[model samples]
Every structure is written in structure tokens, then in C-alpha cells.
Target: MKKVLKVIGITVLSFIALIIILLSFLLIKNYLDSKKPIIEDTYYKNFQSDATLEKKYAGLGSYEVSLVKLKSEDDTIKEYKIWYPTELKSKSQAYPLIVVTNASNTAASVYESFFERLASWGFIVVGNEDKQAGTGLTTSKTLDYVLELNSDSDSIFYGKVSQDNIGVIGYSQGGAGAIRAVTEYDNSNKYKTIFTGSAAYSLLAKNMGWEYDISKVAIPYFMSAGTGSSDDSGEDSKTSFGGVAPLSSLIVNYDGIRNDVFKVRARINGAEHGDMLTRADGYMTAWMLYQLQNDEEARLVFIGKSAEILSNSNWQDIEKNN
Candidate 1:
């Protein structure tokens, strides 16, 4: 009887120890995740071009911003938002459309600043209103809805939006889905390009049974990541850009580089998982303007003195290959 009690005590002690170890492991993991590098304004304080940020529109000028919300019980974009340039009064030009959603899966309201920035630059930016970032289907649906609107001749936006100049942008998992969307939905390649920030879906996508090829995408691919230690997006961008000579050509998105057909990879300093989602600053703005509008001044930022400005500010690495 004494031996039996001793065995029971030993088993109880062993179970208690296991529980302690599990709790400790969880605590450590939580602590480490909280330490991932994040963008802080102080990080850019010493930058030489910090002075320019104070000027209007990050020195790119501005436009009147407008918002449209779509919310219905039967709509895919239930409670979504669309930010666009309102200065198209009595105009007849089809503007490029840029769609942005968060991998964070929050409402479009959470990313107002980023969308506003894109819209101010004269691109129609749409975001899903729901927290459905898991599949990225809704993001595509948002684009389809806008395209449908553009076809309505009686609608205010009829013939005012370009069908071929669409760009899909997102961060983390949302970014991966955006990349996949280029091949999955737009099979004919309606989208002129793709821009993803830190989407390492090589593992997650497969686990979820979403098999996609990064190489099949033939459009201009622009990817950015932080040199920080965390593999937040599964290193999908880094791996894709570094996988092969033909697969990944490194070139900085600059003037005259586009005519040559190149891929761009930008490494940013102190950019955490959420920086681009909230504030990609002049970098994304310049890239979009260059890609969609063929804005020369915007091109200068990526390839000219303004490039120096960002170099002075926070960009650690910006290179591309054709």
C-alpha cells in the first residue's frame, strides 16, 4: 500500500512539473512575439530628410478625398469603405484602382490613413468592410464590385476607372492572398502589377491547402520586408525573391527600370509587421504613382533625389532585377 501511494505521488508531481513547463513556454513565446520590431516615429528622427515630412502630402501634393461605404446584409463587402479622389468633377479619364486590405483582418476603418494616402495620390483605393482576411476572396470581390460600378454608364464612376491598371496590395497573409489573386482570379492578367509586404505563405498556404506558384505571376512584382529578426510573413517574399536567378531579379523600382521588365525588393529599417499597413509613407505612394500614372516626379522618389530622401530617412535596402 505504501509503494502504491509513492507511485501515485510521483505521477502527480510529474504532471505538475509538466504544467509548469507549459506555462513557462507560453509566457516566453508571448514575450518574444511582443518584442517584434515596430515602426516608431523616433526611429526616423535622425534621418536627413525628416524635415520634408512636415510639408503637405509628404511633399507630393494632395487632392480632395472622398469616401463611399457599401454595407448590406447580402453584400460581400458588408460595411466596407472606398477612398477616392473627388477632384474628378466633370472629368472623363479612367483612373487606376488600388485595393488594400489588412492581414490583421480588421475592418477597413482601421486602415483609413493608408487608404487616404493612396486616394490622395489620385488612385481609387477600396477596402473590405469585414474582418474576412482569411481567404482574400472578399478583397477580390471588392475589386469586382468597383469594376461593375465602372460599367454602369448612369453611375457617377462610369468610365472613370481603369480595368487594366488595378493593383492588389496587402501585408502578411493578406499580402499572400493578394499575390495569389493575381494568378487565381485575374487569369488574363488584368492587374498590371502586384505589391506585397512581408508575405511568407510558403508554409501557411500549403497548410491551408492553397497551392499557388509565385513564379506563374508575370506582372511587375514589388515586395518589401524589414530586416528585423521576426519571420512574420513566413519569409515568403524573401524566399521568392532569392529562390532563383530567373525567378528573382533584383532591381530598385526607379525611372527607366520599368521599360526593362524587372522585379523589385525593398528592405526597410525598423518596419514591423504593421508599418506598411498603417504608414508606408512616400515609398508606396511613389511606387503606385509611377506604376499607375507614369508620374515622373514620383519616379524620381524611387530612382532620383527623392530616393535619396528616403535613403536619408529609413530605407535600408532598395534593389530590383530585370
Candidate 2:
């Protein structure tokens, strides 16, 4: 009896030790992952090679990029990071602007390459270091601040921001913030379009007090999520709708928007929640180009029977009411 009991105790101790080791490994892995950039060159290369639109817009654009930081006196407004064309100061024409909202626990710095890539496309991209940007308040204020800079002669952006051409984008929590930035704020009407990647679903958003009414979105809206397990909640028969911004949830938001309003929702075939931030860069950039810059080539990707995105195997469950 003593030998049997001793063997069982040893087995249990070994199992507990194994569990601790596995937990420690996972924690260490997560820490390392947080330190790395979400977008990897190999992944981007593979994505760009898969489709025409992705090949065209996924690469860096023609403009040389420059970055600037604006420190604030207000504690809530930590700081703002702006990425733009280096030639903006020498150009005579005002450039379009894009406001970016940060995901939960992620600052603008984590997405530096993304902003730089967007800026290379000739737009001024601005983001604040607000980790909890799901509220949209910081995003709205950042837009106002940039507009103020556009009017200040001492500012580099003075008279150089195309007031009529502005867009906003967000990822994860920032995605929820992007919707609110265009619907909940006084300057809501100022944004001509909005985009979100892996945005929190309606139920999760409400539980977190980041709820937004998609029906209130009057501007051109494009939203996307991933089909990976991380995005799946596994609570429903529609497994695609289980994750952070599952297909079911996306459908709810899409259907809520008026039919006349330009709205789209799609999910990357195998992309995880975090991957959505940069995995769908091609379509996101093309959407901005079509809406904000009126680029005909970009328009081809979203409109007409030959829409490139419609045929891309890397994407699934695409829905657009044009």
C-alpha cells in the first residue's frame, strides 16, 4: 500500500511540475511576442505575391517618409506621432490625412512601419500613444489637434492638410475607437471614411463599455477580421463568429449600416487577430486611395465585377454593398 501511494504521489508531482513548466514557457513566449513587430517581412511577401491588388499596394509607395513627435502638456494626451511625406514642406498642394487609433496596450510606435508605409503613399498619418483608445476621445482630439496645426503658420502642416480628404483607421480596440471617432464625436462628419481590423465585436464592446452604433456610421466604412482560432469564441454554431470580431458580429455591424452607405466586411482566410492589423494592408490602403485620393486603380480593387478582392483566395466571406 505504501509503495502504491508513493508512486501516485510522484506521478501527481511530476504532472504539476510539467504544467508549471508549460505555463512558464507560454508566458515567456508571450512576452517575447509583445516585443516584436506584428508584421513580418516573410508574411507580407507571401501575401503580396498572392494577388494583384496586394502586389501593387502592399509595397512601399513613391514618397520618402519622415516622422515627427508632438509632446503634450496634458497627461491624458501623452504624445502624438506623425508620419508624412518628406516633400510635404516643399509641395504646393495639400495632402490628405489619416488618423490612426492604437490597439489595447499597444502604442503607435509598435506600428511604426505601417504608418511609414502609409505616409510613403503621400498621406499624412497621425497616431497618439493612447493604449486605451477604444473610447475614441483621444482619436477625435488628435484629429482636432492636427487640424489646428494645419492652420498654425509655425507648424509644418500649416495649410498642408486637405481638410476635405480625411480618413481614420484602427486595429483591435482601436478598431472600436475608429467607429466611435466617426460617429460619437462632434467632428464625426469631418471623416470621409473609416476602416477597422479585428475590431471588438458588439457584445464584447458593450461589455467593455466601448459600444458603438454602426447604423450611425454615415461615412464610407470598411472593416475586416481574421479566420484564426484566436478570433473564434467557440460559443456559437457559427464558428467564424466566435473570435474577437467574428463573421456573425461583423455581419451584424454591416447589416446595421444603411444600404446607401458604402460598407464592406471581410475576413482573411487564415489570419489571426493580431495578424489582421497588417495582413490586410493592401485592401485597407487601396480603400483609402479609392475614397480619399480617388485613385482609379484602387477603385478597381473594390468596384466592378472584376474586383480583385472578390477573387482573392486569401480572403473569405467578403461582403460589400455598393
Candidate 3:
């Protein structure tokens, strides 16, 4: 009887050991997956022509900006900011409009660099003031306010905001809001593209019952994040980007020069969540120019020669759904 008992104990101990080994292996694999692959400097050089590169990456456009205190009826967007070219009125055609939401516990002005940079690219960027982490009501409200301004002949954006092109962007909580904007509000013309920076993951979404399936979104979506803890350690960004169908090229019908989808991961090795507030100069703009303006140089950065450069880096985990 004692021999039988000893045999049973050994079997149980062995089973536990095997379980621990399996768990340790999985943890190691996940850690490796989150790491940068390798470094290649030649592939990292500026790949665009002098003129095109300057136009998209330089942020040198002479654009003026304005800020407004919104009324109480504005849902969640209590305040807003606008950045437009000083020459907006001089142009015959309307310019694109892009709306932005801020990270939780911060205000719209915190992302002033983000809005102003996109504006320098010739889009009318509207930054929303929101503090809530779980709700995106503010994101949709920004566009609604733009529509109102565009319709009001007395308003500054009247006849100046292009209805055909619109963009939504956000960071952290606002990143989640940007996703909610299109998935919940569902407007094709107003939300032509969505770029999320270090988006809040499902845990936060679950707390508010605000989570939505990424598969439901049909537009071009780009997810950018830092592997650092500041960017949620790419926690949600990984899951979000991975959830989408790699057939995004067919879904959004991006330009014919590329065969891959518009959706992919831009995992910067050293970047953090708040770093997006001031940096992300070329990384974010390239996606916008590629999607909104169909800029060839920007497209090249995504899937062109510049992309070839990025593929050689071990500091970034650039992946697409497959």
C-alpha cells in the first residue's frame, strides 16, 4: 500500500512539473515576439525624394491654428482646437478634415503637436477635449461639430471642410475612442481612416462595457505603439492589430501599387505612450498621407522601399494580420 501511494505521488509531481515547463515556454515565446527583430541602417535611410519627403515629413507648411470653448450640448467634446493653412480661404477646393481625441486625464491641447502636424499636411484637424477613459462620445461629437460648422455659412469652416475626406485619431484612451467613433457611429465619409496610438486594451474596455470587435470596422486602420510600458507595453495594440483580417487591402481597396492591407503594426522600440504627444512626426503622418492623399512617398514608407528598411530593424515588430 505504501509503494502504491509513493507511485501516485510521483505521478502527480511529474504532471505539475510538466505544466510549469509548458507555461514557462509560452511566457518566453511571448516575450520574444514582443522584442525587436534586428537592425539594418541602410534600410532606415530617408527613402522619399527631396521634394516629397520635405512636404510630408518636414511639417513645414505655414498653417495657422484656432481654439474654441464649446457649448454644453457638445456631448463629451467640451472644447476643441482647429489647425488650418493660413491660405485655406485662398484655395478653391475644400481641404480634408481630421478629428482627434486626447488621452485620459489629459486635455486636447496636450496633443497640439499631433493636430498641428496633420494640419500642416493640409487637413483641417479638430482636437477634442475629453477626460473619460472608457467612453468615446467625444470623438463622434467632434465630427458632428465640424459638420455643423461646415453647414453654417457664417462659420469659419463653412465651405472649407471637405466632406469626401475625414480622419479620426487618438492616443491611449482616446485611441480607444477613435475605434469607437467608427465602429459605434459608423460613418464612411466622416471616418475614412483611423489611426490609434497605444490604444487602451480590453481590460479597460471591459470595465466600461465599451469594447467592440475589430472585425466590424471596415475602413483602413493603423495601430502604432511602443514596446515600453508607457504604451500599454503594446498590450492592446498587439491584440487589436492581430484581430484584423490581413486582407485589408481588399477590404479598404488601398492603392494598387501594394498587395498588403492598410492595417499593420508600427511598434517603435523606444517610444512610449506620452511620447506621441510631441513625437511621431513621420510615422503618423506617413499613414495619413498614404490613406488620405494617396501620397506615393508615404505609401512607399508603408509597403515600399522605406518599408524594406523597416523590415530590417530589430527594434520594431512590424506585423500584419495573416
Candidate 4:
């Protein structure tokens, strides 16, 4: 009877242990899921493809700027803007291209005005509108677009574009997309250069379990982020996002040469996320023209003059713990 009691007790304990282990596993999974940010509903209203609209409007001014639309393999309609100097003409219009990505929820059209400024500096600028949040219109989509543009280089839509001389630039969420693009799509040495503003702490975030790897990009990248908020409205957002902590950490770990890997420049002060594209004192464009085109004057303006202005600007600093 005592032997029988012992066997029953062992069985009960074994079952209890198994139940405890399963419950612990379930609790951990729930905790991890709770920690992640919930993706918000992202959608745009009255969306118009720049390609169709620009065709109807024709080209204008000394530099031509138009909207281009592309359809991905999955039938995803992506929007982008094209800009190039008029003096280059059609046949002589083989200008370098820059792909700009905007904030996570913002569209490429939001940064359209900056395209003109970049175009005036003698390069073709294309701003990609993010679809379904700010992950990217989709990496495969940007690659297909570049490939299509390359294949159809003789077509009127892309005839003037120099597919061989490709570059990319992005801000905020677009910056993340830019990194993803260069890492995954621009792998074939198609895009020789890349630039980003207020790049997300993707790698660091990924390392923390998010799984992003934009820092692996082995091209020339000029990256920057605001130091502080210019207005009071951005205070809460800035505090929550960790500001420049991720970018600074990435740069500190950046094992790249000045001419290769990535060249990162950060602007501190009360600079907000949207301010990265502002031409208030030519802070953003100056650096872009220099690195993207190897323009000496633009480089000086970008590194020398812009730094001075940023020094005087009010920006926030990322906290160390972040």
C-alpha cells in the first residue's frame, strides 16, 4: 500500500511540474507580445500617381520635376518624384538619381519641395511614398522600379535617368526604408551612394529583437538627426523615441571609412524629425549635394557652414540609457 502511494505521489508531482513549465512559457510569450508597439492604421486619401499627372502637365522650368508612378509585381502602386536640370537636355540628361524616403507615416509627396532644391544642384531626385506604414513601398518594389527604369532607359519615362549612377536619401521612417532598400534591393552595386536624415535605430532595435539590418550597407551614407525640438508640441514624441541615441550608437560602432561604408553626420539642438528636410539655413541639402555628387563646394557648405548653423540651433540630445 505504501509503495502504491509513493508511485501516485510521483505522478502527481510530475504532472504539476509540466503544468508549471507550460504556464511559464505562455506567460513569457504574452509579456513579449505586450512589450511591442501596436502598429497604427496607416492610409492616404485622394492618392494620385505622379507619373500619370506629370505626363499631362509636361515639363517645366530650368530643372524638370515630375511625379512618376510604378506598379510592383503584387500590383502595389508606388509613387515617386523625378527631378533633373533642364540644361542637360534629353540625350545629355544622364544625371545621378537620389531616392528619398520620408517618415514612417508620411508620404514621399511630403518631401516633394526638397526635390526641386536637390534637382537644382544637378541630380535626378526620386521620393518614394511609403505604403502600409513606413516599412517601404516594399523593398522588392523599389528594386523592380530601379530595374524597370534601367531596362527602359531609352523610354521617355526613364530615358534621361542614369540608372548606373544611382543614390538614395531618406528621412525618419523613410530613412529606415532607405536602409532596407540599400541592404536588400540595391545590393547589385546599382546604387553607389546613400543618405539618411534622423535614421531610426533599426539595427539596435533589431538587435533588441526587431530584426532590421540597415547598418550593413557598404556604401557612402550621409546621415543626420535633430538635436532638440523647435516647438513644444514635439517634446513628448522626442522623449519617447530616444532621439539620436540609436544613430549615435550606430555611428560609434560604424567601422567604415570616410569614403566608404557610411559617412554619418548628426545635427543636435531643438531639431525635430520633420526639420531634417528643412532648408532653413541649407543644413540638409548642402551635405547631400557634396556627398552625392562629390561637389567640393557643396561638401564645404555641408560640413563647414551647416555645422556652424546647427551649433547655434536649439536641438535635443538623446539620453544615454536609450
For lDDT, the strongest prediction is 2
- Give one digit per residue, the lDDT tens place, for model 2 in 245-308: 8778888899999999998888898889878777888889999999999999999888866788
The window of 10 residues in a row where model 1 has the poorest summed lDDT is 243-252
Highest TM-score, which number?
Answer: 2
Q: Return the number of clashes found in candidate 4.
A: 19
Scored by lDDT, model 4 comes in at 0.51
Summarize candidate 4's per-residue lDDT along 143-193 as a digit string, tens digits.
456557756756454665666667776665566666666765435366677
Cα miss at 159, model 1 (Å)?
1.0
Error of 4 at 237 (Å): 14
Q: Could you estimate the TM-score for every candidate?
A: 0.69, 0.86, 0.68, 0.61
After TM-score superposition, the amount by which residue 294's alpha carbon in candidate 3 deviates from its true location, in angstroms, is: 1.8
Local distance difference test, each candidate? 0.62, 0.87, 0.61, 0.51
Candidate 1: segments with Cα more than 4 A from true spot: 1-60, 72-76, 186-188, 208-211, 232-260, 303-313
Total backbone clashes of candidate 3, pairs 3 or more residues apart or in separate chains: 5
The clash numbers for all candidates, in the given order, read: 11, 5, 5, 19
Per-residue CA lDDT of candidate 1, range 145-197, in tens? 77888898776678888886888786766765676677677532667877777
Better of 2 and 4 by lDDT: 2
